[model samples]
Target: MDALANAPDILSATAENTRHREWRLPRRAVSWLQVLPLTAILVVLFALPTLLFLVVSFFDYDRTGIYPAFLLDSYREIFTSASTLRVYGSTLKFAAIVWAITLFLGFNIAYFLIFHVRNPKIRIIFFLLCAIPFFTSAIIRTMAWIPFLGRSGVFNQAVMGLGFTSQPLSFLLFSDFSVVIAYVHLYTLLMIGPIANSLSKIDRSLVEAARDAGASRWQIMAHVIIPLSKTGIALGSILVITQVMGDYFVVRQMSGGQSASIVSALSVEIQAMQYPPAAANAIVLVVIVALMVGCLLRIVDVRKELMK
Candidate 1:
């Protein structure tokens, strides 16, 4: 009789536990719920806009207006145009140069802050100093370079005053050099932010262990830090590349209209009421950017690297 009575109690406990679990959701379902808002926003904003452009890119258009139809002429024209090739080549060149410069600056700066600095307060202060420029308008920042880099600008005046040169440097403003300078100023922060975040999460104990094993700073950085920071470096490179590829004004103003970006060419098409061709350009640029990012991801399994 006692054994039979205990069986009933055990059954009741199991049933109660099952009932409690019924009130909880599966982890996957909870994950989906968490992402629902952003997914909806992306579908509405990015997805819908991209779809709209894709449709317009296929439509027929001319001097009269855009017509509703499917055609390959827009893509054909874009692919066939030598001007399109030149603009894209120029944009890629800019992206590549900017990515290299930003990566070096960002990695070194982040490394110093995360590893070299013992004081948390000073590290944060230095990071804030790097970010302080962002509080001002980007346009103002780009234009400010004019007075600092022009023939009679601060930099030129300083060089001449110090007898470094007989005349002010002409290439300092309104040239490819100036465009690069502006890009580095604007986008280096993007690189620094991602890299700093990645470096911060690294296990400090591993670095110490490496040092105890007689690993020099260079060896530790080569074998440990660089391997660990791949995700950050890739992310920073992506940000810098994309920003340089899509830019218009900085190149235009700083280069003195001598150079044009893919987007600048696209902007020209838009201004001329060439919607189909402009939409085509937009789609192509998106594809190119996506391909470049994809290549970076392939180079580093960023997901696996970060999780580890």
Candidate 2:
């Protein structure tokens, strides 16, 4: 009778445990549930459009309309055409230059804001000052540079007034130099924001400890700050690279038809109703950017760092 009573208790406990497991979700399942909304949004907004582009890139198009067909002509032309190659090369060149300049400016600016500005209110004020230019539209800001850098504009006039040169600098406006100036103006903030965020996460004691160990400022920066801030640097680089690569307006307006970005060339094709070729161009650009981001991710595990 005692054994029979104990057996009933054991059976009831087993039943309760099974019910509990059925009600409780696994940790992995919870994570998936939390991310499902974002996944859906990305698929709808990004992945689907990319898929459409990939599919359309293979189609055929004529003066009348695009037709469903499998063709490599678009891809072949992009690879073989010298003009296309030049556009790609110019785009890459601009991206690399802008990236380097932004990285330098962003790192220093972020370091100043994060480390030097002891007052939180002062830091916020400085950050707001850096962000003031971004209150206006990008197009408006880009156009503002035209007047400033023009041969007869403020900068040239100032230089001429100072007797720095006898003539207005022709190279200052409607050239690669102006294009780079505009790019740096527009995108440097992108770098600063991320790097500041990364720098803020660093512990202050680590620097003090380094100082106590007789480490030089440069040594501390190279060993502690840079390594800790890699995630920010990588994020900022991606932002700058992608912005420069995809930009058409700044290059168009600043370079005065002398230079063309990949997007500007793609825009030309789209305007001419060359949908297939435009799609092909877009897909190629996407692949190249993806590769660049992948390389950065390889260097710094952004996901892991961010999670920590």
Candidate 3:
């Protein structure tokens, strides 16, 4: 009688365990299902295109048509040509200058917004003001600078009226000066957003403790705030760097015909149906950018920071 009673309980326990495992198997599969769509999109859109470019870059091209052949001529021309070297140097220089300017402006503005602005509504208003320029098209915004910075434009007139200079500044428009100005205007916001997010996550109590421990404001900022906010700085730097590096339009239009970016040169090649060389140029640019981003990742570990 005792054995019969225990057998029913044993059968019930086994059934419960079996149902639990069945439920768990689908739950595990659901996680993979959630990730599948994004994986498919990346494979199809990004991976396939990149692989195609790599293959095409090795082929031969002529005035007749592109020929299927593995050749290093395209890369050789890129590495050997003096014009290519000069353009690459110019683009790198512009990227560095723009990165520095944006970092300074972005950090200070973000610090002010997060720590100094006590009112939430005022903070929102300030952020909105920062973003207002983006409401217009980037091309329109870029073109607007041309008129403003032109010889007969508002800034020159103001400077002349104020006796700052006797002549309209020729360097103000269609020059490297104008290119840097436009880049700063366009990309400072990218830095500001990331830095502000990092700043917001900082603990107030830590700051207060540091303040109470005879630490000066500057010391606290240097030791406590900056260290904590580096992830944001790194992220912002990456964004600003990439944007400046990849820019063709701002550099072309703002600097007039005096300057040529890597992209602009590649675009010219593409226009002439120089597919192999253009593909090679693209691959080289991608590798250079990847190396830069890799350097940044090595420094900050953006993935690790975000997880915390």
| Pairs clashing within candidate 2 | none
Superposing every Cα of model 2 onto the true structure, what RMSD results?
Answer: 8.9
Q: What order do candidates take by TM-score, descending?
A: 3, 2, 1
| Stretches > 4 Å off in candidate 2 | 1-33
Evaluated with lDDT, which candidate comes out highest? Answer: 2
Cα lDDT of model 2 by residue, 1-308, tens digit: 99854754565555556665663444445456556778999999999999998999999999999999999999999999999999999999999999999999999999999999999999999999999999999999999987898989999999999999999999988899999999999999999999999999999999999999999999999999999999999999999999999998999999998889999999999999999999999999999999999999999999998999
Candidate 1 vs 2: which has more TM-score: 2
TM-score of each: 0.89, 0.90, 0.91
CA lDDT for candidate 3: 0.91
- Model 3 C-alpha lDDT per residue in residues 125-169, reported as the tens digit of each score: 999999999788888889999889999999999999999999999
Clash tally, candidates in order: 0, 0, 0
lDDT against the true structure, each candidate: 0.89, 0.92, 0.91
RMSD each, Å = 8.6, 8.9, 8.8
State the displacement of the C-alpha of residue 86, model 3, in Å, after optimal TM-score superposition. Answer: 0.7
What lDDT score is found at residue 30 in candidate 1? 45
